[model samples]
Target: MFYKEIFSFIAIAITLAAFIPYIREIFRGTIRPHIFSWVIWGVTTLLIFVAQLEDHGGVGTWPIGVSASITIFIAYLAFIKRADVTITCGDWLFFIAALLSLPLWYWTSDPLWAVILLTAIDVAGFGPTVRKAYQFPYSESLLFFALFTLRNVLVMLALENLTLTTLLFPAVMLVLCILMMAMIAYRRRVLFA
Candidate 1:
């Protein structure tokens, strides 16, 4: 029990530390995060955090709850910065789908389904950022995603009770973070070469 609390606090600290530099970069106009991506991430993370709290009784949810809060702040920064980039129609489509999924999950009242759907929405929301990162690799931070992957792993390890609802979101996030890191790396390689 003590170990679980320690792990939870560690996860929370690492998660916040990971985002601080990313947020600073965004504020410095070095990283131009997609508004749609951050917005969906904020909302979906909040939902997942709530589901995790209900399912795990806060054992492994502190990091997720903190992440959701930071995501909201980053989303606001992205919105205000308004980088010199265009938001494609497909991005809007994904955003709408993400918004619609929330109510559907609420209506279903299944934490498992909620996490699954939210995970899907969260990945879909990354579409625009993925596209943008492909074009401008430096527009995103590799360190942030890498640390997020680590944070997810820590959160998973910190889980006192593991279930589909508790595991799905972190697992999906870990994969997505890896994919995003790969995308950024590929873009950097191609752009610099």
Candidate 2:
């Protein structure tokens, strides 16, 4: 019980802290976010928040909920600032597909399947960001992604159910975060070298 509370608080704090620098950098015009990616993330995170609540009703899910809210705000900032915004046609297609999947998720009988579909869409949404990161790596904040990966780890530990439905999203996000971080680092090195 005590450990759960501790991990929950830590996860939420780290998740929020991770975004602070990213948001600050965005305002400072240091890190320019891919608007498509942020928009997709904002929507996907909100869906994941709903799925998490259904799969695991505990304090661990609070971080995801908070993250969803923050993601929306960041998306708004990205839209308004329009810094390094890259939105290809395919990116629009992916977003539409993801948005369309919400109905499919609602039509599904299994909660786990709904979560799985949402996670797949979320992963697919990363394509735009991955392409952007490959082209312009410095536009992203590596520290923010690193901290997010850590927060996901803590949130995973805090989960009470530990089922596939509950575990898959965060686990996938952790890997994606690490991949994005590595891509940014490698691209930065190659470009700057």
Largest lDDT belongs to which candidate? Answer: 1
How does candidate 2 score on lDDT? 0.84
Candidate 1 TM-score versus the reference? 0.95
Collision pairs in model 2: none
TM-score of each: 0.95, 0.94
lDDT at 95, model 1:
80
Every candidate's lDDT: 0.86, 0.84
Cα error, residue 120 of model 2, in Å, equals: 0.8
Candidate 2 off by > 4 Å: none
lDDT of 2 by residue, 1-193 (tens): 7787789899999988999999999999988887777787888788778877887647777788889999999989988999765678877887788777767777777768878888898887888778877888887888999999999998888887788888888999999999999889999999989
Per-residue lDDT tens digits for candidate 1, residues 1-193, read 7888888888898898899898888778898889999999999999989988878646688899999999998888888888535788888888888888768778767788888888888888888888888888898889999998998998888887799899888989999999999989988998889
RMSD of each: 1.3, 1.3
